[model samples]
Target: MSSISAHGLGGADDLPISGSLAIVGGTAALAISFVVLLLAWRQPRFGRAGHELAVPPPIARVLDGSWFRAGLRVMGIAFLAFMLWPALLGRNDLANPLLGVTYAWLWVGLVPLSLLFGPALRAMSPVRTLAELLDKGTGRSGGEGVVPYPAALGYWPAAIGLLTFVWLELISPSSTDVGVVRLWFAFYLAAMLLGWAVFGTTWIGRADPFEVYSTLVGRLSLWSRSASGRLVLVSPLRNLSRLRPEPGLVAVVAVLLGSTAYDSWSSSATWIRYVQSNEVDVTRLGTALMVVIILVVGTTFAVASMTTAVDTRRSARKELPRRLAHSLVPIIVGYMIAHYLTFLVEYGQQTLIQMSDPVGSGANLFGTADMEVNYWLSQNPTVLASIKVLAIVVGHVLGVMAAHDRAISLLPRRHHVVGQLALLAAMVGYTFMGLYLLFGS
Candidate 1:
């Protein structure tokens, strides 16, 4: 199998913006936004659960209808079938649709899909659909399995799953090999099904890497459900504030941010030269570096979060990181868009074209084989760079606002502003680093 670039795009030199200018401007935007938030946003404005505008009845009914949900499941099943065709029978080369579908469409395309529509993957997960079907076939309620899901496992399995996936996509030398990709999916399907059989549908929520990632990003979307199970529209920030602090939450966010950052860093000329010159195994070194980057991100955020003086009677200092972890979702989404925009837009179309002839037999089953990918985004480097910087800056600004609101709600009034200093600094640091990677890499 031929290798494919994980991010199908040109290098930083192709970008029209000056690296130093973008970095400094992005950093200044974050700092200024933080100061503005500190002054203008004094009160705790979010974290009000059930605060949302009710959707129109017709729209709500359509969204909540059984038929609508079943249609989504059907689409999910069809999508899975389409993907499997390439994985199971297609060429073991980059021409296979499976490679682009797995890396670009599903991985990067998920961000925008979830952002526009809430938790699209969860609604469309073939594994969950199959598990549900199995439960029904056995006269089970789909909630209770052989054993209850352990609350302490909260997102830990998903964290590990996500880390493993990124390692394969970003570090593994054979990531594009059709055999390897097929095995990876086989293992994922087996593990998810087993987990569901043992712990019920809850396993999919807490353990499925793609589902968990999508759900987290979905929290930043305007779509949400109310306490009464009605579909409602809510401010993304307020919706994010409702995210419950759970075990392994910090680790999940860390893996996401760190993996994306590492993706950018690994693509740089500096890293490439180092890898070429060293006699060390590239896979081993890449894995180690990815892990270290993840650790550093988690550790720094945890430390920054707990540096504030907290009211011991109300909130435990140790739990602050997890409680505040929701704020990072915006940043993660922003970085994902900036990092994967070109790849998703360009390669996603290519994947669609490839899907038309999954087995390379010249069959136009999907009628897209004759279509060509539009490289508008890549062709306009200035527009692309502007979007990247804007996404990163806007995400950081929203994150700052979210963090401030959480801080005011949690910290003593006397120490509110002071309490957020370290966290703000850390956020600024993250923004700077992210921009540098975008520009430098």
Candidate 2:
């Protein structure tokens, strides 16, 4: 088996780390949180004061033009075509591009693309494109269907969908099978279309797992649609702050982090030995473990947010988790980058090469069949390890800033510093846990 086949869903193998560096990393993360609390902006700055950088008039016009949007829809159709081609007739092994397309390309490829381009996958989602076409064909306005969406549902559906996808990837024994993945996509398509039919485009955004995932990461992108619906560049933090606080916001964030941590943990030899020693069904055990991790992590953050003093009504206090949830987005993105950077670089290339000969007929359609994937990052374990640690630390710093800014905006003046302590501690613990996953995975 190839290194990627083992580490594709898992993380990089055997990263070297110094004990001193790990300690320094943990210390720096906590110290920076305190420093930000003590000396950062007292007034709520990020609340409504995001700076927007202007694009040239022509560029803006071109970006917002119909041609660009149609092109994106075309891209969505093209991906669907790729899926149908191999999904129906391609070989069953890793040699077929279907497996790589699902795992390496789409699963891991979403991170950087969302970060740089802001929900490109969502925009180019084939299911979404088809839904829009259906809506237009039916002559609906504002993409609303016969029935309105249930406001109470919010992102809860998307949260569940995300968990389901992660469960299949991390827990299902047959996850690597091309046919299994194809069946998964088939179900995904049917579900997306059904939801889209019931609630329209709004439903797709709120209920589709990949759409929510991409849009969440897209919050970190430099480009975004402003209030007036024109695409413009803004500070990543400001973009992050603009996230719509909805039901299951914490649940979504928790699943992202917990499943990722579980992915790392599930790959360890220790976990293998534990499973081997037990007579419990692996699927049931793994499923239960993943759910427990998500609940524990999400509940921990929620409780930490409530630890601070609040003079507000109990209703407002109950909303604290949602208010503080945006603070964790950067940390999730950073950790995702930390965990998948090298894996994506290596296997992502391999996926591209496989794409050239998707059906195993030895066709060089994309002219990349002979390309060799570079392993320079793997060769220098120290550099890769350092990058992973630094990514976590930087994410920690940004998360602290977000939490601080959010506290000042919502918490009473007297509860400011003390209220943040619990959140700060949570950030510290989360960072340390992520570091341990890196060093030990």
Q: Pick the candidate with the highest TM-score.
A: 1
CA RMSD of each candidate after superposition: 1.9, 2.2
Off by over 4 Å in 1: 1-3, 6-17, 49-51, 312-315
Q: How accurate locally, in lDDT, is each candidate?
A: 0.87, 0.80
Q: What lDDT tens digits, residue by residue, belong to model 1 across residues 1-441?
A: 213563543445555767787888889998898888878887887866656899999998998899999999999999898777788889998889999989988888889998999899988789889999999988888467799999989999999999989999999988989999899989999999999889999998999999999999999999988887888999989988888889899999999999999988998888989988989898998899999999999999998899874756335887899999999999999999888888888788888888889999999997999998787887787788888888989999999988899989887778887899999999999999998888866
Residue-level lDDT of model 2, residues 211-276, one tens digit each, is 888888888889877777777898888888888889888999999989988877777677889989
Q: Which residue pairs in candidate 1 collide? A: none
* Poorly placed runs, candidate 2 (over 4 Å): 1-5, 8-17, 277-280
